[model samples]
Target: MKKSRYIILLPLFISLTIPVVFALTSKGQMLENFKRQEKEMIFESQTIFLDEGDRNILKTYNKLNVYSSIGDKIQSKREYLEVQNEKINSRVNSLESSIIQFDKDIEELVIEVNKINEQVVSTKDEIDTNKKTIDILQSRIEESTVILLEYIVYLYKKGDYVTTDNDIDNIKSILLSGEKIDELVNDLYFKSIIQLTGQQLIEKHRDFVSRLYVKKLELQESENQLKTLRKQGILERNILDDKRSSKQRILEITKGQEELYQKYISEQLELERDIKVKELKEQIKLNNTKKKLLEKYNCEFVDIQVQQTEFSALDEQCANINKIIFAESRLSGIPLENNPLDWPVNPSLGISSYFNDTGYQRLFGTDHDAIDIMIPMRTEIRAPMDGYVVFIQPVVNTGYAYFAVKHSDGLVSLYGHVNQIDVKLYDFVKKGDVIGLTGGEYGTNGAGLLSTGPHLHFVVYDEEEYNDPLNYLNLSYLSYKSLPSKYQFKYKSDFKSRKGFEYADTSKKQSTSGSTFVIEGENELERQKYLLGTYAVGDFRNWDIWVEESIAGGIDPTFMMCVGLAETSLGKYLKSAYNIGNVGNNDRGDTKDFPNARSAIAAMTSTFNNKYLGKYNTINQLSRYGNKTGAIYASSDFNWHNNITKCMSHVKGEYIPDDYNYRISIK
Candidate 1:
């Protein structure tokens, strides 16, 4: 019956995909694959926790907000602060569990397949031994038959002749033949039974082969399913890795900011609580309220400002406090307060529109309150001075976000269109520490309100009033502005071909061959390591090597540095789809991914030099050449030539030649 069953399933067995050595060789492969997945799971979990640690650190340093109530009275207003990719993580954990189960299943299948293979081998050996015994039995039966026939012949001869002495001997032999025949019959019967048993063993081996074939097919299907799941798991893990990488960079900014803010708050709160200072503030408020400029308890802004429809209740209160403080300072004969500030961003092409630009005035029916400095999306928005964040919120309806920092000098810098806030509220940040990332445009990083594209709306709260950032920074805000691109050309596609622009030739080889990277007997790798030490995350540390490669490709390393800074916000937010320059994503938001950052860098620089070398020898010419057909690099509101030049100057810590592109040496 078992043999019959195997025969019925035989045809299907031929199509089995799993190898016959599944127990020996393929089992090891499955185990190794499972182990690899296990390692990856461990690594990903570690990465996720690393992000949690950073968040916790930020929470610790930022002020903690706690509330207490006694007898139905609540004292709520005190200073302090504080990827839930929970779904992705849960799915990952689940995947790990399933993979573990799959491993166990494969192990069991391996054991079962091995046992069946052993039985088949043993069955085959039994069949071989039985065949030898059957052959030996057949030889004995043949010899016995020959002897019986000889006896029969002798008997016939003796019957035909008279009974002589020879005949008598033959008759005795015939009697002996009968006894031999009996033994031979028994032996032949035993051999027949042995042969039958060997046949059964052959049938049993067929059944074992059929069972192995079925298990192989089953194993193949199961392993394939497991591999598919693993493949998807890998892709999801990579996405989480990218998300984690972005967050890690933000954590670095928070490290400086949160610690500083905590110290500032702790120190300032202690000093302000002194009896004399408290009495002085109370006296000033009391004296100021006696005049018509303020009401007794509400001595902040002008009475008319309180009546204004544009200001929110919170805005009015804040304004009023500033007003009262300013009045007190003035009465005491204090000068209007100010801070010597550098441009928070680059020397912007120019203000997209000044603080309280007309569009805002129309919207709020009041003056615009911030200066819009045009910059790329994800540009690093630095702290204007040493300060702590007092407010951070997402005004989704307004189409952008904003954060406010209270400087120690009684000044405040409010930056808007910021989609990403690295520091929590009350976290202290230094004058030049990156506190957040810039965002604007209707739907780039985050949606924006009246904003058309990426730019920084910078404002200052000084002398109890919102002042122009332009006034403080004193930046060169040229009357005319446009995009900060060397040439203007509409993108036909984001993935432009490097081969299309391979004609730009360099007559002079760069003076140095990666010599600049050999700092203190350390090669480019060592220099990159040192440079990357300042960065919180090491994912992008390898990018520095691309700087060396670009120099070899005949582009200035200085310009490459500036371009990387301007485009990637100093790696704060990388489009991995992009090289340091997001040439892959046109300003219009058409994003295309490259294989990796290094290959993308090589391709972009090669194409850039090929297209622009001879045609636009100088930065200024590149800036002014948009009038020609297909020469549009920047859209509007800034000139790429001037912006990159200024940013390059900032990087070099000095001005470069007016004809920067044409200049042979940075020094």
Candidate 2:
């Protein structure tokens, strides 16, 4: 009974233990998976951050925002700087204008000062002249006074009034005899005569003296008037001196003003220089700041990458936990699957050409690579399968309108000659989704080089190579026989050949020469070696060779004859379809007839090689066919025949040419 009870308890214990073990194991696995997934997420984030696309996006965002901010700041600063500069300029202009005006004033003042100095000099000369005149007048006045006194004393000593009078008259005559003073003083001296008798002279000496005194007084008054005149002359001279002094003072003031103005101009110039220097310094600082901000943005992007990685890790951990918990939740659930095959167009009309063999070449070669279904103009075209829109190219030569859809399993279908493309690239499309409509006569037939008639060319490629959709679909050639009569396609009988020659000429004219070659040196060996090297390994589609021999011969290297061998295998082949020269078409010409083969090869080779490479002299020297001096023959002195042999041997030989070492030795 106890054993049975332990057994029943064991069941409960096992159940509890199993769940614990499972939970622990799941938790550990979830943690481990989370760590692994987190590391992967971190690595992916790092890769994305470093990838060009993501880096460009980040860089653009940073550049745009940083540049915008910097630009805004720069604009604001520029505006402010402009205002400040204007202010400084205004100050400078004002200062300069004031200096100019001051200079003008100084010039005027200088002129005035110069005039004052001249006046001062003139005044000093006039004062000196007046002083000399005053000195002469004083000496004359003193001499006249002394002579009159002597004459009065002589009359008293002579004891004869008449003699005294005579003596006085002699004195007056002497005093009046000098220049212009003689007329005025002669008249004044003669106006009152002095006489003294012997008796009367002694008795009435007092009375005579008195009379003489009165006469003397009158003479003294005239002398005083002369003195006053001299005083007035001195006063006038002083006034002129004062005027000259005032003028000198004004000149000094004007000179001082000029100096002050110059000082102000110097100060203004220095201030402007200082302001400019400050502005340059600020600009440098702003640029450094912008650089620092860019560095910070880079750091921020790195931090964001780290954070995103952390978040992804956490999300993965939580997802694992949920998966573990919900493993059996959908065990009995049903899944829905839908497979839809889309028609290429709307079902408004029947398919004129079914996807099958029609016993003839349609468009893509001897066997049609695609199915041609005739439709009306402007008919809507749709997607044939649920896929992603891969390409929508509207190239003129290849297709009038074309769109491609990429499905799962590397399957791709093309709809050509479309009128329009409504869907965008990488768009997820379902079957029967409308892409575009058909239009133009060109769409009906391929048109120009590619043509048949108005029909939709539907092609499906598997893994990039063209494949017959009918074969892949495992359908019969006439599987649509059971369908309605409208869906059947009518086969053409005895159709005329298209005018393909005109189209070929047009295409040739339009085609561009796609390759160029250059010879390395002026030596014949170098030229031959260059041709051999290029022709042996170069792409056959577009090829040309240049040599220095053309330059020495005064011909363009582009027109060199031997260069065509690199393309047409030395006159062996001519491409008739595009009127191009190639190595593959050699078998078409008669091998027995050397002239016909050579002529055909030479004509095609000359046309293409000359057209593209003739511009340079390097290629012209290598021409063995078109030299004017007839030096290109096999027996020419330039060893033209030997060079061709060397080139052919070098290119065709499995190892290096036998002459290569000998050529090196000669060099």
Best by lDDT: 1
lDDT of 1 by residue, 1-667 (tens): 4543221111111011311112213323433343243233322322132334332322221111111111012111114311122233334435445545555655665555555555555545555554455455455445545654464454445554434455445446656665433222222222342235433433343233333333333344445444554555555555545545544544443445455455555654554355344445545544443342334334445343355543234354445344333332322111233225556787446667666454444344446666788788788888766656655554444334666765533466777777777886445576799988888877654434346677887777674366766555533223212322211121111112222432232333221122121112123233334433333133445644444334434455556554554456435566655555666577566776655555555554554544544355455544342223434333432335545665555444446544677322200
Local error of candidate 1 at residue 163 (angstroms): 99
In model 2, the runs with Cα more than 4 Å from the true position are: 1-340, 346-365, 395-399, 443-449, 471-479, 482-667
Number of the top candidate by TM-score? Answer: 1
| Residue 137 miss distance in model 2 (angstroms) | 99
Could you give candidate 2's per-residue lDDT for residues 416-494 as a string of tens digits? 6666667754455666788777653553422222445555667776665666554333121222333322222211010
Instruction: Give the whole-model CA lDDT for all candidates, comma-separated.
Output: 0.46, 0.41
Give RMSD to native, each candidate.
37.5, 53.2
